[model samples]
Target: MFEWLRVFWQGRIFFLARGDQLPRFLNQALKDGVVLYHTQKSERGMRAQIKLADFRCLRRAARQTHTRVHIVAKYGWPFVAARWWRRKGLLTGFVIIAMALTVLSQLVLSISVSGNRNVISSDVLERAEKLGLKTWAYSKNLDLNQIAKALQEQLPDAAWIGIERNGTDIKIKISEKIRPSIPKEAGNLVASHAGLIKEIMVIQGNPQVHEGETVRAGQVLITQALNPSLPSKTTAPNSAVNNAVARGFVRGRVWYSAEKQILLVEDKVEESGRVATGWGIKFGSRVIMVTTQNSPFEQTNKEVTSPFLQPWRNWSFPVEVIRVNYKELHNVHLERSVVEARQLAEQAARTEVQSKITPMVQIVEENVKVLPSNSGAERVRVEVETYEDLAVYANP
Candidate 1:
């Protein structure tokens, strides 16, 4: 008990002493007025603790007695204070911020939203404020995710709604679904892309390019003005074609290319099996405890669900449970050889080029070119040729 008390009052060091003169070493330490406690014999040598104040005197005693000392551990508040005092600024700032958030979290400070084009921001705020999410209201029990979902349902144009909280501020982001566009009607058959004219089966139009001629994008391959001076064999089998909209198939050989760069070094992140679950209660527009707490993991993936029924469709129920689950993630870096990088780049290039062509179109010829690389990435470009219908509306 005295040893423990002495250690608390002052600071102590645990050390091991080795040499043939162990007994002489202790005698000299005591004669030198050095304090020692918890003395015991171990496999290495005699072990003991001395006051940090006596540490310098003990070293002198060891050298005079030809005994070597090895420090095993340090104890007491002085060492602890010294270690933490270096980070005093960071610790003080963290405490101040934490206290400020604690007081502000109980009251609603600000509510702001963005990305709403057709839906007015005031309408969204009005709906949320009515649902118990407003300025100066209790924010401790309000599930922002639920509020976002409810507000999204009220706005017909919104495709998705995401809500985030920063201290006392709540922010809402919205994404609207895209509307389709109507294409103009076909007037004269024109080349859809730059290609070599392969075959033209004109139904009611004048042949503007020969079979071996090259045409630019949007160039008229067939016109409605069927000139009599043009070659008769190029026209479809009929008496004489009228000025009706030109309709027929014009096959052309076109080339499409795509380039992709693959990195030799990559970082892959995955769950590390450590999880933290935070719990909270939601009553009306306030959320408490769980949702207000920060995640424990440095890097984590959060999964949360709200138990409250929203006010969408003119219905309202503001009480529910909330659980925020966090999963820890660890990153693993991988390095690949040049050969592997080139293979990945080629696959990516092929996938990208396929998106530029129609589903039924078959690649007639394919070529791959790789630039010489001495760094960590490989660049590959893939070019493909295809023969398909090149006719499109010749809009003026």
Candidate 2:
């Protein structure tokens, strides 16, 4: 074996011969750059492993010498196995990881909603869940368009809906229907409060009063219908009566006021109010608390019911919380200061009476009467009474 190694060490060209001619071939072979090695008689043929260039040279020499040669041992099984494993080792692990990630993403874990105003996120998520899209273990074969169509069919109030996937995450975009504004008519309504008439806008009919006109309640501050067409309907029955068409924008003095009662002594009142943290998160069967216990109001115990999907139907998942703590609070009245009381009373009286009357009239006068109540507390009661001449135009 060592001799065979030395014979082929110096980039030697070796020719393998048939077993029968092994000894004869080895004897005639030269020990130069070109050498010959022959195996003993065995079951398998004598195989040759050589560089392509050397193999060509040996073949040509054998042909010139009229010697028949057979090549064997081109590639051994162990060497071929090692080469195959080396080529595939790195890529095998990568392919396995990719397959695992694909399988995991096939199920929906989370859903996000966007572009919604009137519609709440909870509603969108719930509906999305109902449409077979919110399961933690979900099917990647979900048809987005079908899901959207199903949502619209289920929620008619949703103006538009769309669903898409970002890897394992899902996004649902929705837009709520916007109600159209009702058509306004001139002389429909106006502010009767005693404020300098800042501006008067007439949409449907002509303005009865100008921009800076001080008018009284029931006064024709603006007129959608006019009296000029009345005479034509009686005298000339077939004539066209051009009454101011009552169809436009009517805006005038609008005042807002609120008067609240409070004790002279500041008492610590147990005021219960809902303080929404505006933050909430759901994980599995539990919901982590996001709000702190420092809220000024006592929060009533509430059982929050969240829905989880089981491929198609919803399972009730509720979160129950115990009372944490209570904080001392006082009810602070709005516009209840001594200085603001009088003005608030007057404004309140004016708005209360004006809200009940037609906008065609304005509050020309205002009187706030403050009195004492039986509670031994100073009570401020306002009587806002105003008179305006409203023209009742007959329809032609």
Candidate 3:
């Protein structure tokens, strides 16, 4: 109604009124050249708003009718209402477009495979497609349980499979199965090396050995016993009694050796380098330059991206980014005297040797040799001796 009045007034006319007298106000406004009328009334009184294009004629008529005393003053639409309509008109199209896009985006465009080890992502996607996952399809239509079962059937190597929908994306999680090794035959596994018994457990065979006993490679810890006291006749032996079995556990010391070379020089040198970029783009091994200028540093590099091509529908696309950086550097030298060089070399060698030995192994001895090299530099060689408590398991 107010919109109609604005059109009628055409930026002309005026009106005023209070509650309980809006009818009378309209009558007065009509006579005074206020062509259109709008009224909002409450307990306080009535509000009659009119356009100003014909205000003079309407005012004159109102005065003649003795309605001037009720006329408050000329005014436009309330500030709150005017601003609301203005904003509504401005944002209506944008709001509609946003809502439509949001609805359209609810489609499960594709199934994305994530956290997969053995199963290929493409295979997972193909299985999802068979399970009703597809482009421009509603996410609610997807049956996650059915999809998971289909994926498992397609990828038997996967031990675990699950499907989920997050927003517009469908995720397929796959876990690969790890094969269990078959246990060796009764006596096939023996102590690989010699060691004193530290622990013992007997599962399937009779334990011939006890804890604290020393054992060697090929030594049996437990033996299968058919009869403990029965004596066999010379003519015939019981087949069951002949089939006694044994099992054992043993830990043995294994020898290992490592060698390291150290170069002694008057000065030790080191070099260091950086790259920054704005937007991301890539093709093959090369990345397109998105930045306006080359990096200020002497070292800079760019790489390209190779994007995957869709077989059927060509909708969504992605790009890869690659980057490499180079540096121009000169070595900064630190001079070391002969005495300092010898100490540093020895310390370095000791650390290197210790890293190669296990914590369980005790260092029995160490030998260090420092000699002048033909290159006019000192050479350091160190040998370390260690011992390990190789323990074995015996069953009783």
Candidate 4:
């Protein structure tokens, strides 16, 4: 390694020396302190490498010895640099690009969140940004522990939160708090809503009601107790009943109602054919706007386009050209039909009912009604009756 580095720093040249006095020339060159290496005798002449600076002295020695010398090759950084110096502009551009990349590597470009279920990813990212973990933030300026503590304070529901960095990408990992399980021996199953019992399957404890029985909200459908044996009138009954955890599924028919209203008249916007185009240049986080400020239209839809420098590669330049296009828009009053409005209202009603239904519930029957409205708005009402497991655990 040291020899190779030495050769690279002090450029070397390969040359061929011919004639009977080649030996004398070599001796003379050595006497003058010219380093010669890798000397080999060939059929035509002797080939060897000497310091580039010593090549001149070798020519003099070859002339005195009556020997012909010819340069075979040149090698080392100095020669390579000289060759590159011819294309100065390209070299300068490459150097500038390298320096820019070095600076950009320290700045954060994007942030991502993972390992989160109940917590929203955007919420976590927003909190992180507030804590100095946002895009373009210097990596050295951030403290992972401090950011984690801040996030934990804001999201108390998270069991653990961690921040990691990979080049310009920042990753946030979260572990949500685990809810404690309900004890099987300390709760009773009860009806969640008013319904008629359609099926009762007791898995633990004792059953309180049978199928086809009417039950109301908060009514106990299954008891967390052991059944007591029947006692005669003369015999004394047991004072205590074994009250354990009740675990069972009680399916019942439950009803739900949803309503939605739609306006008969509304304003709609339509784009006029006219469009204006403008552009800007973004340097790092700052944008320099170019073109006229005054727009031709009072209302316009604006679109900004900034394409990546290298969309196919993992790394990209921070600089980009932004093009903004504005399209004119005009509003017009439109009258909607009652049938069309009712269809929209019905869709809204069904969405409302679906949002309330749980995984255990199954829809058994549905009914839709269009209400007679004195107001200008049209209203649609939907009634859905479902059969679902009404087993809700409650502390005994």
Clashing pairs in model 4, backbone N/Cα/C closer than 3 A:
185-245
Query: What TM-score would candidate 2 get against the native?
Result: 0.27
Model 3's lDDT to the true fold? 0.54
Per TM-score, the best of the predicted structures is 4
Can you write out model 3's per-residue Cα lDDT over 1-396, one digit (the tens) per residue?
Answer: 988566544542333443344566567666555555556655655555454545555555454445532455534445444566789866788789999889877887666777766467877776677777877888776677877866664553454577777777777776554322223323323443455555565544566556667666546555555544565553235344444444333333333333333444545333344344444465545556565335555434443323344334864345554333333343556656767777777787777777655443446667787765655455677777644323222221
lDDT tens digits by residue: candidate 2, 1-396: 876554444333233455455444444444224433443444553444454334555554454455567644343344555566887966688789999888887877778888776567897678777767776746656888898878865553354578878877888887544322223322233333343344555544556666666654434444555547376556443222445444322234533333333333343444454433322445555556556534444433333433332233565434434233333344554334554654554565556665555433345545565665444233455443434222222122
Per-residue CA lDDT of model 1 for 122-189, tens digit only, reads: 98889989878898887778888788768765553455678877777878787653322213323566
Worst 10 residues of 3 by lDDT: 387-396
Q: What ordering of candidates by TM-score runs from best to worst? A: 4, 1, 3, 2
Better of 2 and 4 by TM-score: 4
RMSD of each: 25.9, 20.6, 16.6, 17.5
lDDT of each: 0.78, 0.50, 0.54, 0.79
lDDT per residue for candidate 4 within 1-396, as digits (tens), equals: 999999899899998889998889889999888888999999999999988888888877887999999888999988999999999999999999999999999999989999887679999998898889999889999998899877965663454688888899988988664322344423566676688999888877678888999987767777665444534343433222334456667778988889999888988898878899877887878877787444678999888787545445786677778877888999978687988889999999999987776532468999999998756678999999988666665433
Sort order, lDDT high to low: 4, 1, 3, 2
Worst 10 residues of 4 by lDDT: 234-243
TM-scores for every candidate against the unseen true structure? 0.41, 0.27, 0.31, 0.44
The parts of candidate 1 lying over 4 Å away from their true place are: 1-186, 225-243, 267-296, 301-329, 394-396
What is residue 357's positional error in candidate 3, in angstroms?
Answer: 2.1
Q: Name every residue pair that clashes in candidate 1.
A: 140-286, 140-287, 141-286, 141-287, 142-285, 142-286, 142-287
- For residue 260, model 1's alpha carbon misses the true position, in angstroms, by 1.6
